[model samples]
Target: MAGDASNRDLPPVDVAVIGSGIAGLFLALRCFRAGLSVAIITKKSLSTSSTNWAQGGIAGVLDVDNQAALEAHVQDTIASGGGLCDEQVVRSVVYEAASRIKDLVDQGVQFDLSAEGIYDLTREGGHSEHRILHSRDRTGAEIERALTEGAADEYESGLRIFEDWMVLDLVRRDLQRPEKGVAGLWCLAPDGKVYTLASRCVVLASGGAGMLHLATTNPPVSTGDGVAMAHRVGADISDMEFIQFHPTALAIDSQHPFLITEAMRGHGAILLTRSEYKEWKHTDGFPSDFSYMNRYSTKGSLDTRDVVARATDTELKKSGDSHVLLVTEHLDVQEIREEFPTIANKLAEYGIDLG
Candidate 1:
């Protein structure tokens, strides 16, 4: 249900937040807690953002025994960024990761724990330590669920959510004056009416522009609407060409490609050449069959995403194969099933089982 704002003529609020993703929802929550009225506008349902579809865990330096982990995390991030990274920004965000994680936990976001009750940290590409905080394989969904539910108590009273409301542009008091700041938004409501919602501050949290590609793992709503509107309002955009592509998106003969998370490799799943996979298809599956990753890099299957993705592309093109196989038959079946119930169920539909 959307476009159902009963009080169209309501007074201006303290903040108008566009998009209902993790960024927008968390912003709204903080503003409301500070005694500010918030209006959250989303183009579609509140739960359809890219954050809800993310499979990987949030990376942070969390282990106490790993005292050198913080600097290591920073260095790894910088290396992954390939000299384009802002060192100060990287240091700030990495150092503050623990507190932000604590904030999420305080808001009832439960991450996966080992049998000993410690965090079940897993290593993905470009990391030296296992510092990822995740809830099984569906970390993003878990985060979205937690934030959405946590904000429910303050919804009607403190935060006003406008779903199916397409934000067309940011409203400025003086369009000609460049120094004048954003005042609010001009949104096209679901009721086929363009309404002007006023606020002291307007926040654009609309997600990335992955939909610009014909084939992408990004949600359909990721049409780069936020960037577009920001450009129109003369916002200074940076690093517009540095979009990262996931290396192992599922390439089945489907219109929408599903992401084959890099975490699968973190859990000992192997990427195999089609010929190697066919050779093992008739025999009992073994780990040796999926050992092709070592041929590409010294880190083997644990290489950084860009490396792994480029290797996969190279192998596919070299062999003229449409798709490659991710082999997990050697991993413990029960562990894989329980740790990745969502992914297991999804593969089950395609007659593939990690178990």
Candidate 2:
């Protein structure tokens, strides 16, 4: 059926959480576990989250004994932040990474492990250690699945999940009050009807506005809805200028673009200039020259996201090309296929071989 709320009289809840991504779902689970009645309002299906589209794994230092690795994680984060990072936030995240990772596992999300049965951590751009734990290339999807299943188990126990329902705005306690307290939200159901579901507390977990770009890896719902709602209700939002752009995407003109994970680069893939790609496209393997990225940093392909993206932009402008290339030709084909089945299959569908 369509809008389930529109079909019946809505009930008041202890908490109304807007959005159904990882953040929203996780918060809802916690609140529900605490015996609070909860309702999750999502604009589309629960799966249409940027969290689901994320290809790389969660970054965390699972080893408590590795003090050096933990400090390196913090340094790597600050270094990648390009001096704009808050030292406190970097320290907090680096230190708490192990617990947060354990939390995910406790919630039934399984990250990839090596054949030795330990977590198969991988390094990505801006990382000094192999702290990125992924479920192959579709780490986000696996996370979404686990979290959604976690919610499903609680559904009958007063956890309400409303998919295909859009949150229009936050209802304030008193418009004239000095401190505007949140009462609930105005939701737009699939039947084109608006309904007010009152709550003791309202949480906005709506995601970012990456789709504001002409081309982005963000989903359609990432149009700054949560920010706009909070802003309209007099909430102060900061650090919005910080938008992380994935440096590489499959750039076939006639096809829709998809992200080419930096994980590829982390695992010895190289970025080639347009001419270089065309010149060596058919070659079985390429030289270990570290051509394009070395021009930006000594780390070459393993450079930070901003550096690599800037390097790609510079290469494009200098060569008058539309896009640069992510070359995997030099890598082991079977290993590439096994390690990145998601990406390998996707590229294969486009008449392209990842290696």
Candidate 3:
């Protein structure tokens, strides 16, 4: 219920999983269901991972209803991933996206549905269609909560969960095991005690490596620990460059960075400039002159994240402005409030009223 000390003398389990993020939780559930004893070790509280802070919905083909849309989405992802993306891996993950969502739904993960009872999908900047399945704006939170609950049920049986257990290094016996075979690990407990956990199989689900940058939406614990550890053990790393940056972050002076959900833009918001504001104020009396996004892509505000962010940065530089504005005049004020209550509240805290 609280914490567990590692007893090196105790018998090793079938599998030892590091990190309790989405990847870890799902791995534990699958292993448990397969009758494999699992021990999950996390460096902090269970809910403190990057999965909890994820606001954008997962990309999947839930509503495509045809192969063309699915192929297009896959192609778009491949293009965005650059030439480095493995076509086989892309096809594998894309093909499984729908089944994965279905599995989540079967596991009691509640995805948002429209009034017509179809899975409510949203369009993100890089995406071609409205294929992202979500549960309101807190989609990741919802999924994590469900997975955690499911994991708890497994724990009720015999699954082991260790919180505040930071892994210092992995223990691999054979350095020449074809694919970097793992044997065990050396971890540091919250009390500064060292642990040697031996296992038949070891999994490193320790999330992304976003902390290397000055400004990252990733949590404090995401320091590329897993990647670093794996690399230390001679494991090959891939895609070290594909870091996605959201176009809108709350541009406030704070010790910690806060991300403004891109879903707000998907809901019909427009990025405006100060000069464009002045021009619109004198002419149309509404900010419509800041249409630089239209020059890049037909998706405009709904362009993929990389496109929109680049466009926004260009506009800010060209206009000699520190901050660009996102206007949601097309969206009903009350609807925006209801859909993005957290964002509206945060903006209000900064003396900017959404209404």
- The runs of at least 3 residues in candidate 3 whose Cα sits more than 4 Å from the true structure, single-residue gaps closed, are 2-6, 63-65, 82-84, 175-180, 285-289
lDDT of each: 0.83, 0.84, 0.79
lDDT of 1 by residue, 153-215 (tens): 777565788888899998777899646878888888887888888899988899899989878
lDDT of 1 at 310: 84
Worst 10 residues of 1 by lDDT: 1-10
Residue ranges of candidate 1 with Cα displaced over 4 Å: 1-10, 63-67, 278-292
Residue 60's lDDT within candidate 3 is 87
Off by over 4 Å in 2: 1-9, 254-256, 277-290
User: Which numbered prediction scores highest in TM-score against the true structure?
Assistant: 2
Candidate 3, residues 148-221, lDDT tens digits: the string is: 88888877888888888887888878876727578888888776778788888889999987788887778898
Q: What is the lDDT of residue 250 in candidate 1?
A: 67
Residue-level lDDT of model 2, residues 1-355, one tens digit each, is 1334634447889999898889999899999999899899899987779889888788988887889888889888888898999999999988998987787889999898899999988889988777799999999999999998988888867688888889989888998762767888898887778888889988989999887888887788898999998888888779988888788888876333788888888888888886776666556446436367776898888888889888888888898988777877778999878889889888889898878
**Local distance difference test, candidate 3:** 0.79
